[model samples]
Target: MYSTWPNLDTKTIHQQVLKWINERNNGLQSQN
Candidate 1:
């Protein structure tokens, strides 16, 4: 779970979430 702090903007938060998810998925894909 991610901690929501520092009152980040919606767009920034959305981008951050997307980037983290993509990185996680990419790692799995590369391992297979």
Candidate 2:
């Protein structure tokens, strides 16, 4: 899936993944 983004460098991709993980964690916390 990451491969689909043509111009994203490693640092950008890492940041995006971190942001996504944080969002998912927040969602899970809210549900609890």
Each prediction's Cα lDDT score? 0.84, 0.92
Model 1, residue 9: distance off in Å is 0.7
Model 1 per-residue lDDT tens digits across residues 1-32: 33565577777888988999999999999999
Judging by lDDT against the true structure, name the best candidate: 2
Residue pairs with backbone atoms closer than 3 Å in model 2 (clashes): none
Q: Which stretches of model 1 miss by more than 4 angstroms?
A: 1-3
TM-score of every candidate: 0.69, 0.80
Hey, what RMSD does candidate 2 come out at? 1.4
Clashes of each: 0, 0
Error of 2 at 14 (Å): 0.2
Model 2, position 11: C-alpha lDDT score? 83
